[model samples]
Target: MINGSGFEWQESVSQLINVLQRSDFAASFLNSIKAISDFDSAVIMAYGVGPTPKILHDQLDDEYKDAFYDRYLKGAFILSPLYQSYKNNANGFFHINDAAPEGFFDSEYHQKYYCYSGLIDQVFYLKQFGAGVAIVVSLARTRKLPPFSRLEKMALKSIESIIISLVAKNWEKLANDEYKFCDYLNKAFENFGRSVLSKREKDAVNCMLRGSSSKSAAREMGISTETERSYRKTIYNKLNVCSHSEIYHLFFKSLEFADRGEDCDPLSLLWHSAKISH
Candidate 1:
C-alpha cells in the first residue's frame, strides 16, 4: 500500500523484479528504493570480520564520495556511530543521531569529516549477516531539509525485508572482489606503526592520511590545537619521517611491499633508532 508521487506498489514490485534480473542488482536495488522514497543521497557498504569496509553502491556527490573513502573509510569507519550500531547487531532503520554517542555532533570526527557532506540528517537501514559482517544502506538528508519524519521512516521500514533479501542474494557477487584494497589498508594500519606509535598518535596519523589538517585532526581527537601539533611532531620523530607526504608515501609503499609478501617490518632497526633518538 506504499504510495508516492505517481508510484504504486505494483510498479515498485515490478521494478524490483526487473532489477533483480539485471547484472547490477545493487544499483537496481538503490533505484528501486528511490522510486519509493526520496533521499538526497545513499550508500551501500558491507562490513566484514576484517577492517576494510566494502562499498557496494553509492549515490553521493563525487567530492563527498571521495572524502568518504579516502578519509572516513580508511580508519574513521571504526568510530562511525552507525558502524558501532551494526557491531552491536542492531538492525533496521536508525537515525544517525539516535545511533551516535552523546555529544557526537560536537565530536571532532563529526566536525571535520561528517560536516563536509552538508547533510543535516542521516538514516541507516542495516542488515547483519553474522557476528562480524553486515550490510548498511545509508540515506542522507541535506541541511535544507528537515529530519526524516515518522512516515518516511515507516516507508523505509516497510521495505526492510525486501532490501535484506536482495542484499543477501547479491552480496557474494558484489563484495568478493571489492574488499582487497581495504584489507591491505587495514593490514598496513595494523602493522605499520604498532610498535612505535601510541594509540593517539596512530589516530592522528589516520586522520591526517585521510586529508584532515592538524587543526581538524586535533579537534576530532578532542585535544587542543597545540597538543595536536605536538602529536604530529612526535609521530614524525618516531617514524623518522621529515614530512606528512613522506609518511603517506611510506604507508602505501609498505602496503605494496606487504602485497609482494616482503618483510616490511616498521619495528626494525629504523624504529628502534627513532625511538632512541626521541
Candidate 2:
C-alpha cells in the first residue's frame, strides 16, 4: 500500500499506469507529479551517451521554450547543478539549492540562464537506468512562490519508487530511439573541429559543451583560468561563434545535417562564412 504525507499515492500510481501505456508518457508523468504538489513549471530530460541532454518534455512558457531548447539543451545543460549530479551517478529527489555547487549562484551560468529564467526554486527527481542513461524530472517554483517545504519534499520522496518503476518500464522501449540520437551527437562532437581546431581548443570546446566554467575547465586541464578563457576565445574565433548559445545552435545544426545523410560540412561552412565577414 502506498502512503505519503496526505498525498493520494495509490491514485497517482493508477494514473501513472494508464499514462505509461500511452505514447506520450512524458507528459503524463509530468501531470502526475503536478497533481500532488503543483509547481509553476516542469521539465523532463533524458541524458545518455551525448554531450547534450534531450528535452523529452517541458511545460515552460512558450516565449522561453525555444530559448531553453536552443540554448540549455544545446550547451547550458553542462552547467546545471542537477546535470552534474546525474553525471556523478546521484539518484533520488533533490532541491536545486542542495545540489548546487559552492558559489553556484554567483557563477556565469546562473546569471545567464537560471537567473534570467525567473525560476526561484527547483527540485529534481533523478533516475538512472544503467549504461550512462538517465532521466531527470524537474519541478520548478516561480519567483513569487515559496520554496518547497520539508513536508512537501518528504511527500514527494515517499512516491519516488512508483515514479522510478513507471519511468523504467517506458525507458526500456524508448532507449532504442535515444541510442540513435546519442550516436549522432557523439559523432558530431567527435568530428566537430578535427580539421580546423588545435587539440587544446577542441578540448576547451568539449569542456564548455559539458557545462564547465573557465575555472572548472582549467582545473581539469591543469591550466590557469586565464589560459582557459584564452582558449575559449580562440575557439570561438575559429568557429566564428560569439556566444555559448551560438555554439549550441552550431552543434545542433551539424547533428541535423548528419542525420539527413547530407554531404554538408557545417563547421567548414561556418568557418568560411566567418572568414568572408572579416
Candidate 3:
C-alpha cells in the first residue's frame, strides 16, 4: 500500500506542479490530497484582518454551498473552533473531532449547519502568511464516506510541509483590499444582549451558544451551579426566549437584522422589527 501510494503521490505532485500560478492550482491541489484520502468537497479561502474571508478557490457541490458560503460566512464561522484556532494564530492541519469545542458535536451550531450540510467530517490545512492574511483549505467528507483512517492521517502529516510551502508561495501576494471589511456580524454575536443582559448574563449566553451546560458554564465562569441556572433564567426572561434551543435559534434569527458596521446587540433590532411588523 505504501509503495502504491508513493507512486500516486508522485503523480499527483506532478499534476499540481503543472498548474502552479494558474487559476486551476487550488483545484489541482485538492485533487493532490486525494492521493492520501478521499474528500467530498473542498474550499480554499484567504482570511485576514477583515469582516469576511476571501474564497480563493472551491469545488463545493451545489448541496453544501448554502451552508458553507452563505450561512457560515454570514456569522456562523465565529463559533467554529477551526476559525477560532486561526484567530489565535495556530496553523496547520486540524480535523473536526480534534478542533471543535466541548460538546460541539451535540451543539445546535453543529446540528444546524454541519449536519444540515450533510458533512460528517472536515479537515483543514491552514497557514498564516504576510501580516494578518492566512490561507486555509477545508476538505470535507459527507456521510457517504467514513472518517480519515490512521494511515491517511499519517500520510497527510508527513507531507504537510511540502503542501503548505507550495500553497504559501502560490498565494503570497494576495491583495489586502480583497479581504478587509467591518466585522459587525461577529461583534453582534460577541456583544449580543449586552444592553439587556448583565455581565454575568452575557457570560451565560456565550456559554449556551457554545453548547455548555449550566454546571459546565458555571465552572468555566467561576460561579456556582445555582448561580448559572439563575443567570440562564434571567437571560431567557430578558430575551423572551423559553429554552436552550430557543436561545440558539434567536442568536441567528437576530443576525438577519444585524448592524453590518456597528457593535450593538442585534436582538434589539429583532425586537424592533417584530414590533413594526405587528
Candidate 4:
C-alpha cells in the first residue's frame, strides 16, 4: 500500500533499489527511509570512514543544520550519552528521546539548548561492518514522535542490511584510495613547514599559471598584499611545494584518483550538485 505518500510499498522498494544503484550513497540511505517514514527532516552521520565524522547528508533548516555540524566537529555529540547508548545496543534501532538507559538521554546540555532545535526525538541504528568499531546511523525529527511502527522498523532494518553489504565490499578500497591521495598531497607539500612565502609568492605562482600577477590576483580577491602574503605562507606550509611549478604539477598532471569508490566518481558529483542546487 502506498498510503498518502504517492508511491506504493512495492514501488518504494524499487525506488530504494534504484537509489542504491545510483552513485551517491547518501541518496540511497535517504531514499530507503523515505520509503517508509514520514518526517520533516533527516540526517546521517558517518564515522570511521572519513578524515572526520560528519553529517554525510541531511535535509534540515540550513542555519540549524550548520550549527549541528559545528557541534559535531566540536565532538559534543560524539561524546554524548545518547551515542554511548547507541553503541551499547547494536543492530536494533531505538527512540532517542524515549525511555533510554539511565544517564543516556539525561544530558543537561541537550535539554538546555538542542531540545529546542527540533531534534527532540530520533531513531538510531548501529552497524559495524567494515570499520570494526560501531558506526551509528540516525534518523531524527525535530518534533516529538511515537515509536516507529512495525512496518517502519522493518524498513529501517532492510536499509541497514543494504548498507552493510555495500560498505563491506568497497570500504577497504575506498580507505586505501583516500590514503593514497593524502600521501601524494603530503609529498607534494613537504617544503611549506620551513619558510613561509609572502603574498608575492602566491600571486607569483597563481598568476604565472593563469596569466595573473600578485597585484591582479590581490585585486581580484580583494585583499591587501600583506594578507595575500599570509595566505601564500599558509598554502606553502600546507602544500610543502615551494615553487609555483611544483604546486602546478601536484594539482594538474600528477594528480591521481584510483581505487576510488563509486560514490567518488563524476556521476556522484553530478548527483550531489543537483541535490545542492535544488
Taking the tens digit of each residue's C-alpha lDDT, what string does model 4 give over 194-215? 2334444544343333323445
Kindly report which residue stretches of model 3 are placed more than 4 angstroms away from their true locations once superposed: 1-4, 175-178, 213-227
Q: Per-residue CA lDDT of candidate 1, range 1-278, in tens? A: 23364346447666666666456766767766766666767888888735567777788876567668786676566557776687678987787866776546665567656887667788888877664578888988776567777887778777777677767666644445444333444455556676678889888876666556667777779999899889989999998889876876566545433343223444343444456889
Which of candidates 1 and 4 is the stronger one according to lDDT? 1
Better of 3 and 4 by TM-score: 3
Regions of candidate 2 where Cα sits further than 4 Å from its true position: 1-7, 49-52, 182-277
The TM-score values for the models, in the order shown, are 0.62, 0.65, 0.87, 0.48
Task: Please give the distance, in angstroms, between residue 202's alpha carbon in candidate 2 and its true position after superposition.
Answer: 9.9
lDDT of 4 at 260: 34
- Candidate 3 weakest lDDT stretch, 10 residues: 175-184
Name the lDDT value of residue 15 in candidate 4. Answer: 55
lDDT of each: 0.69, 0.71, 0.79, 0.47
Off by over 4 Å in 1: 1-7, 172-278
Query: Which RMSD does model 2 reach against the true structure?
Result: 5.4
> Roughly what TM-score does model 3 have, to 2 decimal places?
0.87
Which candidate leads in TM-score?
3
Residue-by-residue lDDT tens digits, candidate 2, 112-192: 788777677888888887777888888887766787887777777777877778777776654554463444444555566
lDDT of 1 at 122: 86
